[model samples]
Target: MDLLVETFFNLAIMREALPLLLRGVLTTLALCAVVIPLGFAGGLVLAVLGTTRSRWKRFLLACWIDFFRAVPPLVLLIFVHSGLPFAGIELTAFAAVAVAFLLNNSAYYAEIVRAGIESIGRGQREAARSTGLTATQTLTWVVLPQAVRNVLPDLLSNTIEVVKLTSIASVVALPELLYAADMARSVTYNASPIVLAAGFYLLLLWPVVRLLSRLEHRIAG
Candidate 1:
């Protein structure tokens, strides 16, 4: 146990690595804060537009969402960061990750939102119409509220997934937590930094997962 403590719990290593890891955490959080809402909003718009009466518009949006969804996130990240420059578009590593994350996340969120919207009964729409509500008002005031409640747990779970996915940004040297861990490990020639980073991930996500479970149970009840 002494050797283990010396490797992982050494105060000198901790003092040196912890601040870098914390900075990485801040970068990840900042990305998450932007990506989550922007992705959701983009998806919501897609879902709403998908419900339109125009068949051509619906088909186009469906194709766009499917293309993004079918592409792997890492591949998309590399394509945006590396390939875009060939096409006369330039982006920083951080911007590339943001673009890829937004696109990939929006596709997932669009499908989830679509499922939630479809889950609401047609009778609800009819009831709203009978009460002299416009199509817009009916959706805003009635159907959407129920659909959102039904899918709230799933959305939160997706949020957790997003948090974990942010680690992939390390591939581009964005200085996210995983990259910080990698750098620390390289400097110390020890695996402890990686383990510490894993612990940090668990610390960050475990509570959200538990909360998601509770919410699912509550909804089921």
Candidate 2:
């Protein structure tokens, strides 16, 4: 532990890499900030479609979820960044990374939302319908509001996952936190710089996970 502290202050964090690493964190956070919400939106749409009674819609939605969930987001990132241009759908490096995360995170979020929706007792829906509420109205007023609350903890937890997943974007030449670490390591020929970068991510993420834990506990309680 002392060695870690010394390495942190004596080597990378003490050197000029602090600001560069901060820039990496900024980029990572920015990428997630955009993609996380997009993922939730996509996931919500997917969940709604998947829960529909139509077999065709459920099958199609399941196909989409399975495809995205099966493929690694890193592979998707590479395809978007390098492969898509061959077909004329060009995307910037940032756009590719963002789109990949948005799609991947959405798949996971859909499952979370679906679980929340399914947890609702069947009586609630029947009760709403018996009150003369339309299907859309019952879903909007009775189902979604309660389901969203039930799923808030899952959503917060997934935000942490989104933050971690941004590291994969580095392989596509996006200058996320891990990429900054690699750059610093290359220049310094030092492992400490890379450790510092990891520390930065942990430092940023730990508190978030802790807060999410509390939120989850509160919601569960």
Q: Which candidate is the best by lDDT?
A: 1
Off by over 4 Å in 1: 1-11
Best by TM-score: 1
State the local distance difference test value for candidate 1: 0.88
Model 1, range 63-102, lDDT digits (tens) per residue? 9999999999999999999899999998998899989989
Note the residue pairs that clash in candidate 2.
Answer: none
Candidate 1, residue 2: how far the Cα is off, in Å? 5.3
Q: What TM-score, to 2 decimals, does candidate 1 have? A: 0.92
* Model 2 lDDT on a 0 to 1 scale: 0.84
Model 2 vs. true fold: TM: 0.89
lDDT of 2 by residue, 1-221 (tens): 87756654556343767777788889888887888889999998888777789999898888888889999888888988899999999998899887887778889999898988897888999999999998878878998889988888888888888888889888988888889878877776556667888788899899989988898888778
State how far residue 26 of model 2 sits from its true place (Å): 0.9
Q: Quantify all predictions' global Cα lDDT against the true fold.
A: 0.88, 0.84
